[model samples]
Target: MVTSFLLLAGLGVLVVATAGVSWFMLNAMAPDVLPAFSTFLAVAVGVVTVEVFLGTGLVTLGAFLYNLSAQYSGGVEIAVTEALTGPPPANARALLLMARARRRLRTHIAPGDPGAGDRSSGARPARAQRETE
Candidate 1:
C-alpha cells in the first residue's frame, strides 16, 4: 500500500517535470502561445490527480473486501523452511542474532486463523495475553 502511494507520487512528479520542461521550450519558441501550454499542463495534472485517487480507492476497496471475505473463509497459509548445504559464513554470528530477534517478534497465529480464539486448553487469546502483559 505504501509502495503504491509512492509510485503514484513519483509518477506525478515525473509528469509535472516533463510538462514544465515542455512549457519552457514552448514559451521560448512561441511566446504568444504560452496560454495553450499552460492549459495543457493543467489538464495533464488534473488527469494524473484523478488517476492517483482512482487507483488508491480501488486498492483500498479490494483490500477491505478481501479482509471481509477472509474472516468467513480462512485465509491462505504458507510454510517456510531454511536449508543450508555448506558451513555457515563468517557473518554467521550476526545472522544468528538477527534470526533470534525475528523469532521473538513472530506471531504464532494469524489474525484470521480460526484457532486464534481457542483458549479451551489454557492458551489465552491474543487480546487476553496482551491485557495480562
Candidate 2:
C-alpha cells in the first residue's frame, strides 16, 4: 500500500512537470483549450503500470534463477540477531580509553619480535629506551 501510494505520488509529480512543459510548447499551435486533467491522469496511470510491471518482472526472474541454482548447491545463509540498543554504561569512556591504550601498547612494543604476544605481563619500552638518549 505504501509503495503504491509513494510511486503514485512520485510519478504524479513527474507527470505534472512534463505536462507543464508540453502545455507551454504546444500552447501556440494546438487547440485553444486542452484536456489537461484527462491527459495528465492517463499518462500517470501508464507510468505507474510500466514501473510496477518492470519491477515485478525483475524480482521474479531473480528468484527463479536463485531457485534453479539452489537445487544443486546449498544456497547462502544469513544470521540475524536482535540488536541491543540503549545508552552506554557509565564506564563506557574508561573502557574505550583502556582498549585504545592497549592497542597503542601492542603496536609500540616488540612489533615484529618473538614473544610479542606476551604483553599481558604489563611490560613496555618507555621513554628511557628512546634512540635520542
Candidate 3:
C-alpha cells in the first residue's frame, strides 16, 4: 500500500518537473521560433514523458497483480517456451505467439538493447590503411 502510494507520487513529481521544464523552454524561445518550437516541445514532452510514465505504470501494475495473485494461489510459474506457445488453438495459441513475438521485437528497441542500432557491438570501424598497389 505504502509502496504503491510512493510510486504514484514519484510519477506525479516527474510529470510536474517535465511540464515545468517544457513551460520554461516555451517561454524562453524568441517569438520567431516560439510558436513552432513550443508546439513541438509540448507535443514531444507530452508524448515522451506521459507515454513513458504510463508504460511504467502498466508494467508496475502487471507485476503487482502477478505478485498478489501468486501470494493467494501459492504461486504460479510458466516456462518461456510455454508462455510463447500458450496452451492450444482453442486457447488462441497463434495470438499468444504473435503477441510474444511483437513484444520481443519491442524489447530490442528498448533503451539498452545492443541491436537497437546497426553499430557493431559498440566497435568502431578502423581507419582504412593506404593500399600499396
TM-score (all chains, Cα) for each model = 0.41, 0.32, 0.29
Give one digit per residue, the lDDT tens place, for model 1 in 14-107: 9888988988897898898667766878888998898777877787677778777777899753322377465457578878888988776456
Ranking by TM-score: 1, 2, 3
> Local distance difference test, per candidate?
0.73, 0.65, 0.61
Best by lDDT: 1
lDDT over C-alpha atoms for residue 32 of model 2: 61
Candidate 3: tens digits of C-alpha lDDT, residues 34-89? 45645755665666566556667776687778878887898884223425653677
lDDT of 2: 0.65
TM-score of 3: 0.29
* lDDT string, candidate 2, 43-65, tens digits: 76677667766766665566667
- Model 2 residue 77 lDDT? 31
- Look at candidate 3 and tell me the lDDT of residue 67: 77
**Model 3 lDDT, full chain set:** 0.61
Instruction: Give me the runs in candidate 2 sitting further than 4 Å from their true place.
Output: 1-12, 32-40, 52-133
